[model samples]
Target chain A: MNTIALLPHQQSPAVELDYTTFQTLLRARMKQAPDREFLVFPETDRRFTYREFYEISVSAVDWVGRQVEQGGTVCIIFRNTPEFLAIFFGAVALGITVVPVNPDLAVPEIRFIVENSGSHSVFFDPDMKGKLVPLEAELPEVRFSPLADVSELPKVDVPAIEAQLPHVEMTTPAAIIYTSGTTGFPKGVILSHMNFLVDGKGIAEWFQLNADTRSLCILPLFHNNGLVVSLASALHAGGAIIMIDPKASLRSFWALVERYNATFTSVMPSILAAILALGSDGRPGYLKGIISGGQYLPPSLGKRFESRFGVPIFEGFGSTEATSYSCFQAYPAERRAPGSVGRVMPISEMKVVDENDMEVPDGTEGEICIRGANVAIGYHNLPELQALRFRNGWYHCGDYGSRSREGDYYFSSRKDDLIVKGGEKIYPAEIENVLCMYPEVTECATIGIDDAILGQEICAFARLKEQTLVTESELLAFCAQSLARFKQPKRIVIINHLGDMPELPKGPTKKILYRVLRDYYERRLANSQDPEGLKWVLGSQGGG
Target chain B: MTIPELYAALSPLAEQVLRIPQFDKTLTMMSTPSWDSLRHVQLLSAIEQKFGIEISGDDAFKLTSAEKLVQYLHRQTEGKPQA
Candidate 1:
C-alpha cells in the first residue's frame, strides 16, 4: 500500500534532528541554543532549557552508570514531572531499555509490570515513596533510588559520547512498552530507536509543530501516546513542553493551558467529553488546536466541541506498535472528516486487508495493518504471538476499519476481544481470570456494554458454584485489589447453572463463544431484551 | 434549595456515578475512596443533567464537597424553584 501524508505539502520539521541516539540529538540542540527552554513544570514553577536539560540528563546517565550495573533493564516509574524526563532521557541515552510505568496505578498493578519486565535499577520520584515502598517484596532485585538527588548531578564529569557496539543501533531495542494483550498477561512491545526518532519527526511534521509551539503533557507518561505525541514530538520540533501531573482536575487542565499558553496537545476522548460538558467555559485559551487519539472520537462530539470551542479537533489513530500515529488529519488547511483518522503519515504504509492478507477495496471494512519504521519489531518473549500479529511484514493492528479513495482511514470496530472504557483498554480475559479466582465462582466471562459517559462498561457474567452464595459487594471488593479502577467490572450478573441455566455457547474448538455473550449483553444494553433469569449481583446498572 | 433538597438531589448522583449506596456529609472528595478525580467528572456530569444547568470546569473542581455544590446550585436556582 502506498502511504500518503495528509499534511500540507509545505510542512516540514523546522529543525531536522536525525541522529544515532537521543543523547547526540540533545547535545546538538544544546549546542545550537542552550538558552532555549525545553520543558516547564508549571505546578512546581521549574523550567529546564535545552542546556539545563542536557546537563541534568548527562549527569543522570553518569549516576546510573556508576551506581547501577550495566546489565539489565532500568525502569522509570514516575508521574509527569521533570524527574520523569531526566530518568527516561538518561536511561534512553545510555541505551538502557526503559519501562515507564504509571505510578498512579495501585501497587499490585505496578508490581505486575515490574515483575514481568526484569529490571535491576528502578528510579522514581521521592514523593511517591509511600505508594512504592510496599512493593519492595514484589521486586526485591530492583535497586531503588529517588530522582531528587539528581539535582546535585550537574557537576559530575560524564563519560565520552561514544556509541557502544551492539547496544546503540537504529534497530536495537530501546524500550519495552506494555499494552493490554488479548490474553491475560500484558505483552511488552519492544520499540527501537528508529521507531522513536521516525515517529517523533513524523508527528512534528503532521502537526506543523515548530520552535514556537508549546505542547502540554496531560496524558500519563507511561502510555506511548504521551511519549510519542507529546514528549518526543516536542523534543524534535525544538518546541517547549508544559508538564503537569495526570491527576490534574478538569479545572486545573484549563488553568495549566491558560497559564502556559499551550498550543499543541493530544487528549483521550473521555477528557474531551468532560471538557465539552463544561459548555461555554470548556475551551482552553490560546491553543493552536488539539488532537484526539487513544480511542474513538465520535463525529458528533468532535463536531460539537469544535464548533463550540472555536478550535479544531483533529482525530488520529495509532497503537503501541506504530509508536504513535499511523493516520492523522491535517488541520488549518482542511477540516476533519468527522469519523476519519485522516491519511497515513510518511514512513508508514497502511492497508485495509481481508482474512487472506490481500488488500481490500477502498470502502470495504477490513483489518487495518501498518508497515513502518515506527512499528515495534515484535512482542517481547512471545515469538509465536509475534508471528501471528506481525505477518507479511505488516503489523496487523487487530483493529477493524476501512480506508477512503482519498487516502483517509475510518475506524469501525475492534477485531480482538478488547474493551476500551474511558480510553483504557481492558481485555476480558484479565477480568475473567480474576473472577474465576474466587472460591464461589465456577465460570465467568466479561464483556463490553455500551455506555453513554464512558466509551464502554465492563459486564461480568458468572455461573456460581452450586449453592455457593456470594454478595456483589464482596466480589467487587475482591476485584478492587487485583485490577485498576477502570478495569473493574461495572456490573456482575450471577448465572444459575440449574435447569433453566443458559450455558454459554461454544465454538468448533469448544472455546466459549465470547461473541454470543457479548451479543447477549449488547441486546440487554438496548433497553428491551434483558432476560429475567439474569440475576443482578453487582450494581443496578445491570438492569435496564 | 435547602440542605434537605440538596441532599435529595445528590442521592441518585452518588448512587449512579460512584456506585455508592447513599450520599451524606461524609462523601466528600477526600473522604469517599471512590470519589477520585475521574469519578468527580462523572458526578459533575450527572449534577449538570439533574439540575438542567452547566457545570464549568472551574466549578467542577471547586464543588468538591456536596455542601459546596449544593450552595452553588442553590444560588444558581435561587430565584426560580422550577430550576
Candidate 2:
C-alpha cells in the first residue's frame, strides 16, 4: 500500500486508526458491540445490529463473489436502503470497487456511467427494473440484477466466507463517485479506503463524535456527502446512523430527528430553506448540530434557520475529489465566524494560490488548493484532467476563495462562475447573498448572461415563497438599494413566473443548476426584443 | 366518506401527479419510486385543491402510503361537501 507523504507542518496529533481496511473495521465493531444497533432504515422500518449486518455482509460476499472477481468494479443503483449498505460494505471488504449511480438518472445517463466505469455488473432496486432492463440489451457485457431485499442473496456460512476473504489493503479503491459535472459527461472520482477512512476520522474528531452520536442521513448515499460525511464518519466513531430516502425525508425531517433522537445530520442549504418554507414548527429535540454543505449556504438562510429552530448549522467546504469536507465551522456554533467555511482540519492542508500556483498572501482572492491523506487518487479514465487538477503535488480545487488573517476560509465561487462584466470580476454569491435576504424570496441563484457590450451581463433567478407576489421591477428596485450599478442584475427571472418551473432547476441533492439557467436564457430570452419583461416571451413559449 | 370511497376518489389524482400506471393500497414512498418527495408534495397539493381543504405541514409528511393518505383524507373530509 502506498502511504501519503505528509509535510512536517501538516502533521498533527493524529487519531489512532486500528484497522487498515473496511473488513477489519467491521470485524472490530462486531466484536466490540455485537448487538448494538448500527444501521437503521426508517422508511422500511428495518434495523440491523452490528452482528446482523456483519452476517449480511458475509452473504453479500458469497453472492457478489459468484458474479465478480476481486479488483473488479460493480455499479449499484438504489436509494438509501439496507440492501445498498449491505452490498457496499461487502463489496469494499472484498477489494472490489463499487460505483454508486443515482437511480433517478435517465437510462442514457446511467448507461454512460456504467460503461465509462467499466462495471462488471449492475445491482439495482427492483423498482428500477422498468428503467434498467432495456439497458441490458444495449450493454450485453454488463450483468443486471434487481434486488428487492438483501435476503434475496444466497446465504453463505459466515466463517466460510471469512476464511476465504482477500487481503485488502488501505490503498485499494473502494468507490468511484461520479460528480454531477456542469458540462460534458460527468467524471468518476476514484477514492481509496484510506481516503474515506482518514476523512471520516477527521470529521468525527473535529465534531467530537462518539458512540452516542446518531447521525440522521437525509442526503443521498450516491454522493460523497452521504457516504463519507454521514456513513463513513459514523462508522469510524462507532455511532449509529438513521438512514432515510433523500427524496422522502424532507417533510419528515424534524419528526425523524425527534423520533430517532438524532444528534447530527448533514444536508444541503436547500433542505433548510424547504423546512423553513413548510412552516414546520417544533422543538429541535435532541438534535445537536446540522452539517450544511455540498453548495453555498446563504448567510440569511443560515441565520434564519438557526434563530427559528435553535439548531446550529455547521457549514463546511470540500468536493467529491477530497472525500467529503476538509474544513467545517467550529464546534458549539457560537465559535464559528459568521460567513466563513471555517479552518482547515488537522488531517489536511489548505492554501490559496495565484495563477502561477504560488501561495498568495492572506485576504487575496485565488484558487483554493488542498493536499492531504483524504484526497482521492484521481479521476477514473481521464488522465489529462487528472494531471491538470492534481498538479504541483496538491489537488487544485477549482474554487475561488480567500483566507482571512484569523485563519478562517471564505468560498467565493467556482473558477468558471466568475462573472467578468466590463473587466470587473464579480462572484455570484455576492449578489445571491443580498437577494436571498428579501422576505418573500425563498431561494435564489445568480448567473452571467452573454452581453454584446460587456461580454457578460448579470442575470438572477429567484423563487418566491408560495402564494407570494413580487414584481420583477420591485425586486430590481430592492437590489438597487444593496448593490452598485454594475453588480446588480441586468435581468431578474422570477422562477415562479415561469409556470413550468415551480422551483429553480436543481440537481438530485437540490443544488441549483446555474448552467441549466444559462441554457434557458440562451434559448428563450437572449434575442428577445424585451429581455427584462419576460412574461410575454415566456407566455409565447408556453411557459408562463 | 368511506375508506373505499376515499381511495376511489384519490386514485386518479395519485395516478396523475405521481405519473404511475396505477395506484393501489400497496403503494408507498418506499415501495413506489415514483412517489418521491417532490411528487409527494404535488400529490398533497392536488388532494388539497380537489377537496378544498388545507393539509398542514405537520400532517403532510405522515401521509407516505396510499392507505395513510386515504385515511387522512377521510378524516379531513368526513362531513364537508366534496368539491
Candidate 3:
C-alpha cells in the first residue's frame, strides 16, 4: 500500500507575502512567484501554483460579479476543496460579502442559514447541490450555480468594479459563519475583515510564521478553526497550503507532509491522536510545530504526540465568535503543563470574571471574558441574546475557565447546553431539530454521555411518528450524512411507543420544553449507572 | 527478524483484519485505509500482543509496514540475544 509513493514530489516552503487588497495581493504574489506551488490535494494529485490559482480565481471573480450584486451576500456551500478557496477569494475580490455554509449541516440548519442571510446567489459543490435543489422551489428569485460550472464556464476577463468603494476596511463584514446557540437555532456570527486579519497576524507572530511555513489544512473550511487559523495563517505568511479529504486525512497526511514539506498547521485533538495511533510509518515529516484547538487535547495525548513525533502539539483556546484564536501555547515547554491553554494573545485582553462582571482571582474558575479587536460584531438579529453575552466592554464567552498565577488559562466546561463531543460542539437543539426532519421521527431529544475517551459523545432519543422500526446504526448513518462527523450521535435510543406523556415544565411565556427532554435523558443515565442499585442496567433502549 | 520475513508472517492477518488485499505484500502503514490514525493504535496493539514483543515508542511511531515492524522487532530481539 506504500501510499507515500503515490504523491507528487516534495518542495521546500516559499513565502512571498504581498499585502493590499486580497485580489491585488494574490495577483502580485502570482506575478512575483509564478512557478511556486500554492495549493495541493495529495489524494487527487491536484496541485496549483500561485500564478495558476490567481488566473483561475480572477476568472471566477468575473463570473461571480455578473451573477451576484456588488457588495451582495454570495452563499457558498462546499467542503474544503481548492475551488472553495478559489470562490471564497473570488467573491471577496468583487467586494461581495461571502457567507459560508457547512456542507455537512442538516436540512433544517442549511435552510435557516440561507433564509436568514437573504443571499442573492449560492455556489454549491456536487455533494451539496442535490440537497439545495429540493429547497429551490420553496424560495424563488435566488440564483444558484454549481461549482462544476465555474471552471467549465468560458473564462471571463477580470471585470472592472462598477462603483468602487473604499477598500473593504477592517470594519467591513467579511463573513457570516453560522454557529448554534443554547436556544437550538443557529446564529450568524458577523466577523469583519479586521477580526480575522488581526487574529491571523497574532497567530502568525506567535508561531513565527515565515515563507518557510508550508501548512496542511485537514480541517473543515466552514468552521473558523479551519478557515481562519490553518488556511489564513498560511496565506498571511505567504506560505503554501495543502487541502486533504477529512475522511481519508489520516491515511494521506504523511504523504502530504513529504509532498509539501509542511512546517505548520492547526488541527483538533482527535486528528492528532489518530495520526499518533498510526504507529511508525504514519509519522509525518519534521514540522516546526502543530497547533491544536477546537477542543481540549488531553495532557497524556499531547505528551505522547510530542515525545514520539519530536514536534510539539501546542494547544489554543478560541471560538467562532472570537475569530478562531484568543490564546495559544506558543512553545513545546508551555505544552508540558497539563490543561493550560496558554496566556492570552498580545492583541487581546482576557479576564476570569464573576456573574456580576467582576474580575475573579487567579486559580478561581469563572466566565472567560474577552475584549479585543478579534471579537465578532455580535450575533445577527439577536439583540437580547447579544445583550446577555456582552457586558460592559467584554464579550462574555459562555464557557467556564480559570487563569493561572502565571497567566495561562484552563477550560472547565460550558455554561450553556453546548456539547463538545470529540472536537466539534454539538448543540442539542440543532440535533433535535434535524431529527424532526425524518419522516418517522415524531419528537426527539439529544444529550451527551461521559465517555472514557473523546471526553463526551452524542446520545439521541427519538419517539417515532408511527410504529416504525428503525435501527440505531441507521440514525447514526443518517446523522453522519446530514451533519459533520463530530456532531453525529454516537448512540440512538428508540422509544417503541408514546404512552401518557409526563408533564413538562412550562416556560412562563410559551415555549417548547427542551429542558424536559434533557432531564428525562439525564435521569435515565443517572438511574442506569446508579451505585445504589445492585443491578447492572444493560441497554434496552433507554436514553443516555 | 528481517522486514521481509515479518511481511511474510503478518501479510495474511493484515489482509484479513483490514479487508485490504495486497496490504503487507508490499504496502506501508500509510497505504491502507484501515491503518488510519485511530485504527493504527489498535493494529499496533494487536501486532505487539501477537508477537509478544515490546515495541519502542520510536519504533511504534515509525513502523509503516510489516517489513519495518519486523526489522525493528528483529533488532530488539537481537539486542537481547540471551533469550
Candidate 4:
C-alpha cells in the first residue's frame, strides 16, 4: 500500500498552515486589503469592502460573545445571506463552537441537533420563526436571536477590534457539523479552527485563488463546501466572496458569475445538470472553473457543462469528518484527471484499505482512509464510535474507492449505503428507523437508485408483519412526518416473499445483508431492465 | 413580441415550469411558489431558449414577471436595426 501525497504546482504559492485561528487570518487580510471588496451581492448591487466586512463582523462578534460563555457552543441557522456568514465568522472569531444547522429543518430536527451540541445560544433567520418559535419553550436554557436579514446587520465603527480577537489554539473546537451514521441519528462532527484553515489553504492554493479571484457561495454554508472550500479559501487568499441568495435563478447563475466577475465557484453534480440544461446562451464572465463535490459527476455531464459554459470543472471527494476535502484536482492545469476525484491534496495523506483497515494495494478498490492536519478529531461525545473510526491513526472513510498507480483516486461506491440526492446526504438507517416504527413493518432497508436529473433518488425495501396489512401510501405518509423531503423514498418495494429472498440475506453475525440488497437494487433498476416491471407487484411510488 | 404574444409564449412554460394555471401580467415569480428561485431559473432557461436571447445575471432579476420580460424582449428586438 502506498500513500499519495500530491505536490503543489510550481506556480502555486505554498499553503499557509501557520494561521492559528480565523480571526488572525481575517485581521491579516483586512490589513492587507481593507479597501478592496471582500463580500459582494451582485443581485442586490450591494458590496462590503474588507474594512466594512471586518467592522460588521467585529460588531457581530461583540453581540454573540456577550451571550455565550467562554468556549460554549453557538448555533447559526440561516439561508445563504450576509447575516449567516457574519454570525459564522463572528462565532469562530470568538473561539466559540458554531453549529451550522439547516434553516429549513423542522423544530424537532433542530431540537435534536441543539440538544446534541448543547448549544448555549442560537442565531437563526427571522423567516424561520414558525419553526424555531417552539425551541423558545422546548429548550429553555438556550438563548435565541433572529437576525432580520443581511440588510439589518449594522456596520459599527469598532476601531481597535484586534484587541477583542479571542485567543484560540489551532486544535480548539470551532464547529460541530451534524452528520448521520449507522446509528440512525445525526452525530455531531467536531472540527477545529486548524481543520478549516488547513483545508481552506489547500483548496485556495489548488484553485489558484488570489486577490483578484472571487468565489461564489452558492452551496449552503452548513456544508463545508460553502463555508470552507468557497468562503474560508477566498478569505485566506485575500480574495473576494460573491454570496448568491441560494434561491436565486439557476439560469441567472451564469449571469451572476459574469456580473460579479467571479473567477471560481463551488457546485454539486445536480447543479451542474441544471446549468447544462440551460445550454450555452449567456455570455459568462471571468469564471475559470467550478469546485464540484458531494456526489459523483460523470465525465459526460462535466464535458457538457464545461464546453457549454466555457468553464472547466474539477471534482473533489471529502466529508465533514475530513473538514473539507482530502483529495481534489489541484493546480498546474495539466495533472487533472477529468473522470476521477483527482490526487490527494498536499496537506493530507490518503490511501485505500481492506475491510480490516489494513492497507490494500494500489489500483484495488477498498475503503478510502485519510490522515492529515485537516482530518477531524472525532465525533463529539461518541468515544466508542470515535475509537472505531480513528483506528491506525487514519480516519477510515466508509467510501469505497481506489487510488490509481498514477496517484489519482476514483469513487467506486458511496460510504455505508449513503444516498446523495440533490447534493444532500441521506443515511439508510435514519429512514429505516422511521419505517421500522410502523407496527406493520417487520424489517426494512433503503438504497439509492440513479436518476437522469438528480444524481440519485432513494428506493426503499420493507418486509411487512402482515402480508396485506399496510399500504405503501400509509407507510410513506408515516415516513414523511419523520424524514426530510429529500430523504423520503421516491419508490418503495415490498418483499412479499421474504423467505425466498436468500433467507432474509444476512451477514455472518446475522446482520441484514445491506450489500446484497444494494446490489439487487442496482440490478433491478438497471437501464436495460424495465424499471416499471419492479413496480408492478414489487414496487409503488412513495409520497413525493 | 407583443404583450399578448409574450403571454402566449410563456403560457406553456408557466404551466410546465411554474405551474401558473393562468399567467397574466400580474403574475410574478414572487406570486407563485413554483416560480421560486429554482423554478425562476428553469423559467429563465426556457425563455432564453424560446426567444434565443441571452439575459445577463444582473438582468435576470429585472425580468421579474411576464410583463417585464416581454417588455424587455420587445425593447431588445426594437433596438435592432431593421434587417
State the displacement of the C-alpha of residue B34, model 4, in Å, after optimal TM-score superposition.
Answer: 9.4
lDDT for each residue of candidate 1 in A145-259, tens digit (9 for 90 to 100): 8776457565655445333312455555678998888787678988877678778888888878988889998787888888888888888788888876554455457766777
**Whole-model lDDT, model 1:** 0.73
- Which tens-of-lDDT digit does each residue in A1-544 have in candidate 3? 1211111110111112235346655666677677787887664467888877887787777677679866788788776677778888778777677888876565656777888887878888755555677677766777878875345644655444313423555455778888777777878888766567667767877887766678888777887877778776676676788776554455356666665677887788867655654443535575777888877677887888878767777888888888898898756454445678887887677889988889999999999988776788778889998888765777888889999998889998788667776566778987776677887877677777655345566778777756588876777767655564457776677765324343333478855455665676666654453331101111111111
Quote the positional error of residue A338 for candidate 1 in Å.
3.2
CA shift at A344, candidate 1, in angstroms?
Answer: 0.5
True contacts kept of 3: 0.01
Quality class of the docking in candidate 1, CAPRI style: incorrect
Assess each model's interface with DockQ, reporting 2 decimals per model: 0.13, 0.26, 0.04, 0.19
TM-score of chain B of 2: 0.92
- On the 0 to 100 scale, the lDDT of residue A36 in model 4 is 92
Error of 3 at A148 (Å): 1.9
Regions of model 1 farther than 4 Å from truth: A1-17, A148-154, A158-167, A333-335, A497-501, A525-544, B1-36, B40-83
TM-score for chain B of each model, two decimals: 0.85, 0.92, 0.68, 0.82
Each candidate: RMSD to true structure?
A: 7.6, 11.3, 11.6, 7.2
The number of clashing residue pairs in each candidate reads: 0, 0, 13, 1
Docking class of 3: incorrect
* Residue B40 alpha-carbon offset, candidate 1, angstroms: 5.0
User: What digit string (tens of lDDT, one per residue) describes model 3 on residues B1-83?
Assistant: 45565666666656655546666435544233345443444455556666767554423445655666566666766645322
- The residue-by-residue lDDT of candidate 2 on B1-83, one tens digit each, is 78888888888888987767788887766556556654665677678778888766446656878888888888888887654
